[model samples]
Target: MAVKTVEDLFLHELSDTYSAEKQMTRSLPQMARAAADPQLAQAFLDHLEETRGQVERIDEMVEILNLKLKRIKCAAMEGLVEEGKDLIDEIDKGPVLDVALIGAAQKVEHYEIASYTTLIALATKLGYTPVLPLLQASLAEEKATDDKLGKLGQAAAIEEAVQA
Candidate 1:
């Protein structure tokens, strides 16, 4: 991944995103289990399925581009997932834990938002018209997930306040 050209950069980013999506597929289930709120748990599970589709969309992009995907692990995603795991291990299961889970999930969603945004920009510059829709779809999903997590976090905070 020398990224000598715009196309090279696009492929590198796309491959990195592919790795990130794969990482999510593995981590989302664990997050779902860690969630104390049933809704939050179901949200994680729902996103797991969406993440799978996102991975498939990337696969489609690869097919259309006639490129072999580079085998690269997304270090950023690895770190994010590890941080979420740490939160789960440290926190007791309750509303507070559910709030924490929302925070952790939002962090991941934010990372994905940035990743997909960059991918879209690179794809546009590289004239990857076919993959633009795929990138945009993933971006929309990421944003929606972020918004959902934010609302969950807010509700948890309000409940905690009322209890206090």
Candidate 2:
């Protein structure tokens, strides 16, 4: 796709995020299973559900915009997920692994935050009024998930990992 206009970029990004959310849904279950901490596991599970909802929102946006429902594979998310799989395979299941998982998960959340922020800004500029709310909803969820992971890391995962 050639860079012609902001609308083109917005569609490109929307497709990218749609793919990322789909990838997360697939990877998150494995992440939950790999977590040593129950809380961390539950967070992954909860986010899996949220990711599903985000996917639906993306679909709605596509329908509203009358855009083709095509997903551009987000290479960044693919790399992040591969790194997570490497962490799971290399690390022994324990506090250290849990902390590592939190770090990996936070990285994913941060990526999502940045992606959504850009999409929301583009949507607003494009006068995509109906799509703005959906983008904002997903952005809010991503930020909340990042905050939760940070609290979990500070409260327990970090200390336990350091001791281990």
Query: Which 10-residue window in model 2 sums to the lowest lDDT?
Result: 65-74
lDDT of 1 at 161: 35
Cα lDDT computed for each candidate against the true fold: 0.89, 0.93
lDDT of 2 by residue, 1-164 (tens): 66589989998999889899999999999999999899999999999999999999999999999987554799999999999999999999999989999999999999999999999999889999988989999999999999999999998888988888
- Residue 110 Cα positional deviation in candidate 1, in Å, after optimal superposition: 0.7
Please give the clash total of every predicted structure, in order.
0, 0
Model 2, residue pairs in steric clash: none
Candidate 1 local distance difference test against the native: 0.89
In model 2, which runs have C-alpha deviations exceeding 4 angstroms?
Answer: none
Query: Could you list the CA RMSD of all candidates, in the order they appear?
Result: 1.5, 0.9
